[model samples]
Target: MSPDTRIHRARVLALSLGGLMALAVAVYMTLGAVGSWSFVLSYRGEKLLTILLVAWAVPVSTVLFHVISRNQILTPSIMGFDALFMLIQTLAVFLIGAATVTQWPPVLVFLGELTAMVAFSTLLFRWLFGRIAQSLELLLLVGIIFGVLFRSVAGLLQRLIDPGEFLVLQDRLFASFSGADPQVLAMSAALVAAASLWAIWRLPAIDAMILGRDGALAVGVPHRRMTAEVFLIVTLLVAAATALVGPITFFGLLVANLAYRLLPGAPLRLTLPLAGLLGALLLVGAQVVLERVLGFTGTVGMVIEFLGGLLFILLLIERAR
Candidate 1:
């Protein structure tokens, strides 16, 4: 396709996705309401904002990860990022007792969790991503292997903890699409926004990183430092998203793969915004339909995961052939 044609297509797709998202938001807020207008909007507005934040952060994180890891099928969750987060949370609860931890200030607890994640992931993922950058199948296999390994280790730790404590851990381990605390939501928004702006400004550097480690450095792109920054942004976004709504395992994979699939050979500038729009639309649209039309609440996470997993499997089969 010609440059002008591609640009026109991208614009059309963006507008379609934006329109769908706006429709979903309207449906979610105003449909079937029975209480005070202020109460209804205030309550649902927070949830909508949280969904939009995840929509932006998860796709950005996944796309940057794919750039560094050079694998679209491998997502932060599949690459054991979620498992690592869970392991850290599990270890903390085991060490400090869930009851005591619950009483601690939310900000302190949140910062501690965020700090530990960034520190650990910076060291571990930098090496792991480097190793898997060249082989797509190997990258996928390694991600699932490490994801299972981390989940197993965390599972062992969780089992050893008190049964009562398991209840607390249970909530943290599963993904939830609703009920994000306002304070945590604010912090996540700030971090995601800052990371996104930095990324857009440094788009040329980021696109260079896509050339692989040696190639990027040959182009004077500071590959090592750029890789670290990418890891930091990915970890921060994934960690924040997981903390907000637990871990939505395949959402990032689903969103990023669809963006690349739809806009093959497109620049990050084009694909990233499309991914964000698709993510928010799939998620929020799912919520509106599930809650309003189907009358099933709290299962948006489940529905999206089911669809995402099917897409992942299909991608694997098609790519393997």
Candidate 2:
């Protein structure tokens, strides 16, 4: 296909995804409303904002992570990022107790969580990528090991935690759209915006990096530096989203891979935006179905994880073939 034709197709796909996302948002905001328009909009607006921010952050982070790792199946969540976040939250509750943690300002908690996540990512990447010069396979293996270790520690702490505190910790661990604090949502929006700007500026480097390390280097891209920069941005985006909504293990993988399939030959500029839009569409659409059709019987996060897990296994089987 001609380059222009590919670009035109990508544009059409993006518009379609964006239009669907807008429709979902409208339906979510307006459907089944019983109160004053102003009150309903103000209340639903916060939840909608949280969903959009998370949708934008998760898929963008996942795509950048896949580019840096050069693996479609790899995600930050798979690399122990979400496990580490859960461990951090669990440890906080274990050490400080749930009451105090809950009493702490949401902004303070968000900053602390973000700081811990970024610090952890920096240390892990430095050791794996910088000091050892690990291959991608080895990096993934080590990440799996770390993920197991983090989960084990979290489990042990939860076992010892007071049951009430454990309940609080459990609540924080699951992804919840309705439970998002407005203050945390505001902070997350700022962080995601900044990360998006950084990503926009690095689109050329990202496209080059998609060609793999040696290929990117051959094409005059600073492979190591670009990888580090991309990892940093991914860490920030993941941290912000995870902090706001809790851990979402497979949602990013699902959205990123779907975006890849939907825009097969598109460049990073097109693919990234499409991925974000698709993420929003999936999330908001799922929430709409859960609330409107299912009568909120279960959380949207669980539904996403269920479907994403199936997709993850299918991708693995496909990869093996």
Against the true structure, whose lDDT is highest? 2
50-104, model 2: which lDDT tens digit per residue?
9999999999999988888878888898778899888999999999999998999
Q: Evaluate residue 162 in candidate 1 and report its C-alpha lDDT on the 0 to 100 scale.
A: 96
TM-score of 2: 0.95
Q: Which lDDT tens digits does candidate 1 get at residues 1-321?
A: 777887888999999888988888888899998879999999889989988988889988999889988877778776677787788779888999998877877667667767766676665654555564634345556657877987898889998999999999887666766666678878988988888888888889999988887899899999767877877778888877776776788898888888887888788889899999999998888878878878875577777788889988998998899
> Local error of candidate 2 at 271, Å?
0.5
Local lDDT at 248 for model 2: 88
C-alpha local distance difference test of each model: 0.81, 0.89
**C-alpha displacement of 313 in model 1, angstroms?**
1.8
Clashes of each: 0, 0
Report how far off residue 124 is in candidate 2 (Å). 1.3
How much does each candidate deviate from the true structure in C-alpha RMSD? 3.2, 1.5
